[model samples]
Target: MSFTLKPRNGLPYAIATRLPRFPFALILLPMLLAGCEAELNLAAVSQETSHASLRTDHYQALASNEAVSVLVGNDGVVLVSPDQGLTWQRQQLPGKPGLIDVDACPDGSFIALGFDNRLWHSADQGQSWNVHALPTEEQMLTATCAPGGAWWAAGGLTTLLGSQDQGASWDTTSLDEDAMLTTLQFLDADQAVVTGEFGLVFNSTDAGQSWQASGNLPDEFYPHTSHFVSLDEGWVGGLNGFIYHTVDGGQSWQRQDTPSTAPIFNFSANRDGLFAIGDHSSVLHLSGERWQTVPTPNAPVYLRAASSGDDHRLTVAGGRGLLLNLDTRPALAAQAQ
Candidate 1:
């Protein structure tokens, strides 16, 4: 038999079925109330506390500088590892927000983007964070710290956010077109590119002071992730299992074939070279004029973020707390020899 139990405060009603005992409502009333109360009180707890150690946390983003490596993920948790991926200390932001992406700034700091239009900054190598609010209500997709000490973030509806003073204040810019800017990356101090829906490609040469639209990506290709090695050379991965290379600074692109059909989600570079990660444990390494597939221990889980440490190793993070370190020092040594 099934029955409806309406919660207090007009929260909503939950139905229970297949009861074998008498006084079911009476027995479950307090338990339901307690659960509701606990759920309500969960948000009251501050997320600034640090975890005892790193667990299998579902990390969404990873970034690294010369000194530290940082990983951010769901439940507002940030993990910092100073010794590459050897050990980590976990910290959290208040309210347990979901951090989608993180980028290493030029000043040895990191900037992470929250799903709730928030920016989290950690100057002390992801040990602590200062949260800053963006000026828009649109969902932020990516955050980047340029080489010139400028911070930039982009999101839906061509929204571009910038701050020159280390995020003390922010300036908002929206383009004339109606498109979601998915990725904003700076190849140098002043050269950057932004790609988004409708094959949109915008370039900035003056530290984002001005932007110019470049050639459209073919076949309405929507970029899932991008990596630019220089001002005129870059790669963009898409949902259709295709990777496009551009030589003329986004003016045109040529598609590169891959072994996997899963959606490519992220890209990073280390001493081994450029790497891309995506669904179905898809990991690609740029080796000698071709994109080579790299085997992963975990399969079928979407890998979203990757970063390279000062040790020249690449660290990748993904769903279900999946973390993997790709060490190519041996290969580098062999090649050197």
Candidate 2:
């Protein structure tokens, strides 16, 4: 069964663009060598199953930086990939269903949020975790932390929690209207956004201290996952092939046409395009405003979490321990589903 973001509320990936390539001989030389090696060994990239270190339920979230990538699933399963997704070493957690959204913090650490307004911090990646109390009964479906542990979380019943003292104490807030806020992300230390069902979206430009209803989506679209390539360009996906693109930092949004009616579970983008995966092993590509459905392994897999990394590696995780790695491949074609 899908781990519902709320008791019933729905929600939101780690990467959405080619990160600024690192400079310096130590960094640049290794990456260039890796890229060359990957190109020289050109073979059709195939999906490899990564059974989590811990036996758990379905994989739910994926996040990445250049040095590390992490995936989390139900039953408190956490997998850490230091060299992209080539090999994932599982990390033990404290308890079951302990996290929903696991975010790669700016400080090289990680933070995980889950039901009962729970939060966990891991200094050495996900090898270990530590809990901090959140003063709310509602589940914190999605959350993120700025460097030094300034954090924000959003979830069911329009709940919002902020921590300035490294989660030592939480300050609560709420929307006037009732909507299940599913995703909370910070673009920088000063700006962030939260999104939910019925097109509900809130923005905070001043470090998430206060929020203003940015705008609701048309047709009451329910956005499941969102990513920002920059403050200006971004993407969101949801039920029934729904996808939205924003060029003006989400001040406005335009729907991207799609053929697959499968519910869009997650989105991750790079300089070339956005990789959107969802139900029925859906893998759709978006370049500019046009979307092209890419053929995926035919199976019963219901893809959920996705992240794009350096060297054209796109890692996706979903139902039944499904983990597909789309390494550097052909140019995506603009074709129908």
Candidate 3:
């Protein structure tokens, strides 16, 4: 099924782009009141049946930089490491606001954007945080920092904000005022791209000083979200497992067939290929034009934050502080050789 963004009272809602062809099933459960902990009945469902491969005991979550890697999630904050998901810590915000995304700045700082248009900054590498009032209460869905030390975030109502002096100050730009932004990538100081609700795609060449819409990516492709892996290569994933690739910046995009229908949350790539992670603790790899499902020893864990370093190491963080390291040296070396 495909979905599009519809604005309701200035907030974005996911609406079906087309009706389902098969019989649709709707399950409604009692809504939990605020401040209630949700409990799932795992006894009724076997481990094999659950798409998530839970390895909660084998991972260690770091509370700070040395031992812990920080990630933003539906919960407040999460720290992850490879030492068996061993240690976990939570930062109590002023309110119980669930964080949607976290970006660690180059200066060992962190910024978290979340529901209600909230923004928090931590200079001590997630040790302590201070909340900054945003221009609006619209959810800031995605954020990224450029190598040049600028930060940009996008979310509800098609709003985009950029900061030149880190998170201390921000300048709101009039980019995509009509579309909801779901993902953001800053390729460099003067170039970046954002994708979100509707078939919306925007690009900026002047460091987000202005933006132009690259409307309605091909109809065969879904527009649930989009992301860039490098300055020249990018991929967008959508509902019904649709994936699209771009080679010449965002001038053109081509559809890619993937194996799973799971909603991809984030994507990262190196010279070797592309990697996408999402629901059911699934990971998808794309080499050249071929896509494959890789078997991981860790099970039922969400792969959330992913960052590729110059050393060909792809670091991923997810469910219960699960950290994954996929070595790209062999594949990359073979490609180069």
Candidate 4:
């Protein structure tokens, strides 16, 4: 399948072609009351001096924001807030490297996927973790929990795994050859979708027991990645800034006009709309049927993640702990009026 380009903003155009290799603290205070009478005494005392040894700092400290409440990074685990892009804390995961994907479970727990094919569960809001080893080292690419108790994961070189007991044990499913699954979404307990490289898109109706090719994406767009917020609404971002949106199930797709041809690393949407971030410090906003470029105060920051919540708020993170918060309320409200 090929996507025909149409300009939405009359800006300079670039064509995408061909595949290429790619916490809180507490304080205490005391109060004193005066009586009718008081007594005082004076005395002289000598003070003693003692020597103590201090240890040197071993780890480099990094600053982060609150907008990112949960993040899985190559270095470690991080959590942030949505209101302000300030104040961040990091948690260390023992014996784990190359942290890839994180998902906030429905019951307030968190699940993390690592490069070594292990899954970690945190029930105390990411303060501590318990690791569960996978049967294979497939390098998990994406993970999502359904509204029910079921959990699903897709990863390395064409492998799909599902677990009804929440990662304690997994059952593998077959996928098309050369299909490196990048993203997975569960609309309900019995319906889901998965997307990956070389225009591979699959849909399952039986709780992931089986899958078939739902549609053919553009082969020219390599390293294809997609995300679905709900069963009926979803977006896919890939090479050369290619983006495809589906309002119905995977029956049809439409190309979304973008400003940059640089590879779009991530895309996210909420009630406010859609946001895409990528190379060259690029960020694009989707308003109804149009795409607009948003200016960034800081340049040369490689955006790795984008998330949107209610009240027209959006947050982005990348490049040396860079955080950006944007409010699209005025822009969106104006367009609506």
Candidate 5:
């Protein structure tokens, strides 16, 4: 089981623990506490901080718009890069909360999730942030902004949340299920999908007002990353190198061949094309008729988040502050040059 260190009674030195899916993450606890041996430094993370330095923080999610990108993860850490991934500035929330997911809105804003029933918003790329309370404390796992300017999030105990005033308030929905919702995506302004444990898949055409079961993923499947090109077409990747494609809006599935068994973490698309990143430094791109593996600069580490840039580049981030800007052009284009 994985181990996570959460604030104990809002104090720096106190320790709270939880078991997670990825046992490999157990090592990250020591890495997070490396610099400060005396006690946990909560204030050091909350203040307005910026530095052109490499961090050993565990980055979990990402959001982007054009040249601006933000990465958030363990210890309330938020890293912003205005020029794609060329440079970065770091900021942290008060309390060193673990941020699980981040999504960019249609109006150039961003929304990030914390496990403590809180949401953080940034209107100026990542220069600053405002925190708001969510309606439930179910440990929101995934978040996304619809093309129509609505915020949606889901997590444990089949909890679902939606907001219109940018988290000023929220509307909560429960599916009455016992599974954890792990991933979500908006196909457009109206259609959206949510997938999670027990292979559950639910679709909503009338925004978040209603949902209907579409299909079930492979038995016992736990989705970690999902990307939908349309309401009727998408891809979901998970542990053991499993990748499935659904062209009929999740009603049916076709297993796709992946290059490795590394757990997939994130998927993104842009003008250049669609891409996926994960553990083992795995980066895969859609090449014509199949998924092709791409090389990474670092050793195997969990690559958890990615977002496309204006210049046809993909900014990737994950374990131990791993970040990179990858060229998205097809192989043939480089070979012909």
Candidate 6:
């Protein structure tokens, strides 16, 4: 379970409690007490916030806002939390399709992609769904909705589709086959980029109307996720622990180093920095230009996706119900066994 509060203008923080949850603690000492006494009690209060760890089936994707958080995964399994993930309920969807990725819109709607290369939409926060077909049959890996009422989907073997009518239908763009397309991101109403297997990265300028092949590095780099903080600066992470950075709007790229060689399945970005999560206990962090490692929990699941909201809280979702929240405040831990 998770808790959501309206965010103040503070640094973005994500905290993922480990295998056994610590009591989530945000110390607020009562002012009515003697000042000296309250100061001493503050430390003790932080020790009492522990509760049961949230348990559920393996999760594949997560999305959220100030009010709702949704986790989707295999067998049409969906969990929705109204209170910023502090509480959850099983949300019944229409099909048993293996859900691959999900995107939450600003207007309380949700869109999901799956194994069959189809798009599913829910107006009621994942309680039900309906399918929207793409232009191709390649397995749809990732999708996003733009602010200007357009939707885009990218997937295997050079498959790219664009929808102008909010995904009622899609048109096949001319950027045809080379490798498996894995991820897509729209920087704004007019610009977008797509990445895939064989180190393929494509850029679009006219609202995905056309494309330009920009980055083609080593053959093994399959960029599964991409995040752009600005129109010029961005990063892509994928298989073989691959991470590439670009500054001139994909004009050129450079590699970043991390200790773990595990595949980086996904990334989430906010005002604070960039964070990537993946297999083999790998969490690569970028605060400025230099990259570092953020240790992850000892769960046996590849963290597949992350959603960073406007608030500082970041929710990372993966297999075996691996949900980790990394934040600034200290969570109350069990007193060392």
**lDDT top scorer:** 5
What local lDDT does model 5 show for residue 85?
A: 69
Model 6 segments more than 4 A misplaced: 1-56, 218-220, 328-337
Answer with 1 or 6, whichever has the higher lDDT: 1
lDDT of each: 0.70, 0.66, 0.55, 0.56, 0.71, 0.61
What's the C-alpha lDDT at position 59 in model 3? 19
Candidate 2 local lDDT, 193-269, one digit each (tens): 78876778778778777888876677777677787755567778876677888887667899897757676767877
Best by TM-score: 5
Ranking by TM-score: 5, 2, 1, 6, 4, 3
Which ranges in model 3 have alpha carbons more than 4 Å from their true place? 1-68, 80-94, 220-225, 229-232, 270-272, 297-302, 308-337
What C-alpha lDDT does candidate 5 achieve relative to the native structure?
Answer: 0.71
TM-score of each: 0.80, 0.80, 0.70, 0.73, 0.83, 0.76
How much lDDT does candidate 4 score? 0.56
Q: Lowest lDDT 10-mer window, candidate 2?
A: 20-29
Candidate 5 lDDT trough over 10 residues, lowest sum: 32-41
How good is model 3 by TM-score? 0.70
Give the per-residue lDDT of model 4 (tens digit) for 1-337.
Answer: 2223332111111122422322000000111111111121111111111111011101111111222355555444445343333334455577534455676666667777765677777777667788877776655666766657666678756788778887777898768566568778777778888877676778878878888787656553443456676666678876556788887765677888766665566776757667777654456677665555555543444556666655565566644445555665544444344
- In candidate 2, stretches whose alpha carbon ends up further than 4 angstroms from where it belongs are 1-43, 49-56, 147-149, 230-233, 248-252, 331-337
Which regions of candidate 5 fall more than 4 Å away from where they truly are? 1-53, 330-337
Candidate 3 lDDT, tens digit per residue, 138-183?
Answer: 5566676665777678876788888887667888875635555777
- Which tens-of-lDDT digit does each residue in 199-290 have in candidate 1? 88888899898889888888867787888877678899866457899999777888886656666778888666878887755667766555
* Model 4 alpha-carbon miss at residue 142, Å: 1.4
